[model samples]
Target chain A: MLKVRVIPTLLWKNFGLVKGVGFDSWRRVGPVLPTIKVYNSREVDELILVDITASIEGHIPDHESVSDFSHECFVPLTVGGGIFNLSQITSLLRAGADKVSLNSALFENPGLVNDAAGQFGVQCVIVSIDAHRTERGSYTCFSHSGTRNTNREPLAWAKEMEDRGAGEILLTSVEHDGTMNGYDLELIERVASRVNIPVIASGGAGNYQDMIDAVTKAGAAAVAAASIFHFTEMTPLGAKDAMHEAGIPIRRRFEM
Target chain B: MKVALINYGMGNLGSVRRALEDLGANVIIAEHPLMLLDANRLVLPGVGSFGAGMERLRNGGWIEALYQQVIEHHKPILGICLGMQMLSGLSEENGLHEGLNFIPGKVLRLDKLGCSLRIPHVGWNEVNYREGMGLFNKIPQAMDFYFVHSYAVVVEDPADVSATTSYGTTVTSAISRHNIFGTQFHPEKSSKSGKQILKNFLDYTPC
Candidate 1:
């Protein structure tokens, strides 16, 4: 049986690791290597490395940087940011990422989602949907690092992602960005119910209990947070232990 | 050292490069013929049509050079995804395409399982090992590895199948012969299982 994942999403800038805020204003965190080393020590289930700057730069992930990151990291790594084509996707995978996350590319060329999943594998293709609350009080999907709004309902986009061959949906709440209030449980439940593939809830996580709530009450297959882990509010291990205590079946350190 | 990610102009190459470099191996995007000569190890990674990949290799002059280096020079070479498919003699993908002939077999496309199972079976798949093969090195048994492919190699000899995975039916997941080894699954992108498999291949002693 697949266990719920407690993933720590890392943002990459140039060759260094940075944290993103509302999809902009990247603050240098440290190098991705040391961050991943700590995550590995904590025995995190998996790591999500998103190149928050890729779409802006108009290039695929910096291979030289990712290549450097992979050398030090010991666990499964999922990379996103600027994955535009099958070649770029191939480059990211071959560079040592377990999966490649796509957002703006999917919205720009929906066929890319299916074509990439067809050539690679659905498991290797992660459709990352960044959503922001609309004035209409419905969640609207945003791409290009949440700058461009698709005006499509979040759940509707999620179902489309699945139908288009996305193995999993990394759903991030733009409204919840940097808040750490807890995941958008309502949004998670909405998307989780709509898509068959596992939904990794991203954004607005406050603490370990937040993870439990996201996974249990909200029915998220995985819970991803940035501020808590990025700022060291809670270590990856402590969070995992907390999740375990909360009765979420997590990947044990020994198992890793 | 320069590593060759055989560009038949299709298949996953980036993840393989990332994994190899993550393991501290110097990698090169091998396309032209001369790229294979300078590399300490050769990594032939693939993803799409078997025939197209083979044609790309042959037309690009990598097939001949790779054959000489692996078969004649006995250098360590790893074939991944469609790269693994090219190790066999032939493939049913995109009609019949001649493989590297390092291993005896024909690659066959998996029949779509009824009930929306989907062709090109994608996602985390478990490889059931028949016996201890070093391709898994330090990895534990029956772990889930990432997979994405519609065609798999049908080994002419049963002994060539190193590992198997079940979808609608049992499919060959990994195959090996002498210094030559092939994996239908993308071990580069399989996470820990993938890392362990690559480590195994990198550290594997010739039989």
Candidate 2:
């Protein structure tokens, strides 16, 4: 059985970990490598490191940091933020990243998705959509770390990305981000139901039940959270225990 | 033992190198075909389209060297992910392209397996092994390994398949034919189970 991935999304800014509310007002968490090492020890299914300031700063992902982090880590590592070209993707992969996530660059040049997927297999390409529900109740996609909003609808954009060779969709709710209330279940269901590829639900996970809700109700293939794992004492193992109790198929650590 | 990690300009070579080194094996990135001559074992690691991978191997003048080492010298070789797919007879990804044909099989898309499972089939899944396969020697039964691929190998000979996994259907996850071995999952990223599998490969003595 394919297990539902429980991922810890660590946001990096100026060489340290940080978390933002609604994608703004960032607060420093700690050094990047130590947090990763913590997650490494906890046996988190996967780790996603996003350089929150990379796109606004107009540079590619810091491959050196990624290389250093991945060397000490064993689980699959995915790096996103400021990946704009195929060469950048190549650099991250060479630096030990298993996959690369695209955001702003994907909107600027949607063709890059096809090109990257062509150069590297589609499995290596991931499209992240940051969405916020509008006043009219319809969701709109945002780019550039949720600073700029696009005219495209989230559902339609997700389908287009899948067709353009995105192997997976990282669907994040801008409104639900950093709030820790719960996932935007409606948003997740809307996109996951439309795309054939796997959908990773991000943002608004206050507790284990929120994670469970994302998978059971929203149809998410994976559930990711930063605040719950970073701020609270709750560990990935506890979350897995909850999911396991809830009857969601998950990979557990092998007892020696 | 010295392991030559083949680099044909794709895949996560760093992780594989680290994983092998952690198991106390001397790992070398074999950029040129001649590097394979100095190593006791060979590892073909790749991440890309089958057509391009085959073209790079051919253009880099690696096919002949690989054949000499794997087939003639009978050096144990392990193929990972795209490397595993390349071992098949042919693949339909990006058009019909020929494979290394070391193992009698063809690579087909997971969706074509006639199941409604999602494409790419990402995440960790359990692998059920056949008895007497050396790779799973100490590894637990139905252990989980990290996987991220859309295509899987369909071996012509049932005897060649060493392990199987299910998604929407039963898919061939591992194949072994004499000195040639292949795994569709990334053992380098599979944590303890993966480490054990690599250790098993390092300890394997080919007949």
Candidate 3:
């Protein structure tokens, strides 16, 4: 049986780790490398590092940092933020990133998804959707780190991304992000049920139960958290233990 | 012992190389087939479509040399992920494409198996292996390993299957027949359990 992935998503801004509530008022948590090292020790299933400033600033992701993280950590590393072109994707892969996530560039040049998937395979291309709950109660997709509204329905865009060669979808709830309340289970279920690809639910994880709810209720293949893992004293192992008790299939850390 | 990590322009070679280095094996990224001559063992690591990967092996002039090393020299070779799929006779991905044919099997899409499971079968999953398998020595049965792929090898002979994993249906995850071995999962990225498998590969004696 495939275990549910418990991922620790690290937000990168100007070469440091930061945590924000609802994608605003960012606070520096610590240096990027140290936080990664700590997670590496805990044996987190996977790690996602998103450069919050990349798309807005029109700069590429820090390949050097990705290389460093890959060298320091033995697990899979996914680098996102400001990945707009095939060359940048190529460089990141060469620099040791297992997968690259795309957002704003995906809308501007939707063909990049197909191009990257063709060049690097679909498994390596991830389309990250940041959705904000609208007044109509339907989720609207946002890009540029939740700063700009794409005005595209999250469900429709998700289906299109899959058709465009996305192997997985990283769905983030802008309304639930950094709130530490819980994931948007309804949003996750709505998106996951419609698509066959794995959906990784990100944002609003206040406790282990929230993680469980995402997988059990929303049909998420994996659950990603930033604030709960970064701001709290809980470790990935701890979260796994709780999830295991809740009957979630998860890989246990081998006793050395 | 020296191990040649084949770089055919697919998959992440960094983690695989680092894992081997951590296990104390003298690892070299063999870009050319000639570089693999001096090595005692070979690790074919890849991630991509079946057609493209085989095309690379042919274009990079690795197919002929690989056969020479594995068949004539009997040098132990372990194929990871797509590299493992390449060891089979053929693959149905992006239409039919020939494989290395070192292992008697064909690659088929997981979705076609009629299981309601997700395609690609990504994430960590348990691998059940038979006792005394060289690559699984000291590794616990049903130990979890990281896997990410849409297709899996369907071995012709059941004896060749050393390990099996289930997603929607039982799929061949690892195979070992004499000097040839292949794993559908990425042991390099599987953390501790993965490291143990790599160590076992390093300690494997090709009879």
**Fnat by candidate, in order:** 0.18, 0.61, 0.66
Candidate numbers sorted by lDDT from highest down:
3, 2, 1
The residue pairs in collision within model 3 are none
Superposed model 3: Cα runs more than 4 Å off: A134-138, B111-116
Candidate 1 CAPRI level: incorrect
Error of 1 at B18 (Å): 6.9
After TM-score superposition, the amount by which residue A227's alpha carbon in candidate 3 deviates from its true location, in angstroms, is: 1.6
Per-residue alpha-carbon lDDT of candidate 3 for residues B109-189, written as tens digits (9 for 90 to 100) = 998765567676778999999888988887778888888888999989999999999888988899988989999999888
Off by over 4 Å in 2: B92-97, B111-116
Using Cα atoms, each model's DockQ against the true complex is 0.18, 0.55, 0.59
Q: Please, what are the lDDT tens digits per residue for candidate 1 over residues B35-136?
A: 778777788886667888888888888877988899998877888888888898988776667988988988887882221345666655677776678787
Off by over 4 Å in 1: A1-4, A12-28, A36-46, A51-125, A134-137, A143-150, A164-167, A216-219, A233-256, B1-42, B64-76, B111-125, B190-193
DockQ of 2: 0.55
Q: Report the lDDT tens digits of candidate 2 across residue range B1-207.
A: 999999889766777888899889999999999999989999998887899999999999999999999999999999999899898899998799999999988999888876567777888999999999998887777889998888899999999999999989888999999889999998888877887888888989866
Which residue pairs overlap in candidate 2's backbone?
A: none
lDDT of candidate 2 over A42-72, digit per residue (tens) = 8788899999999999897788889988876
For candidate 3, the docking band is medium
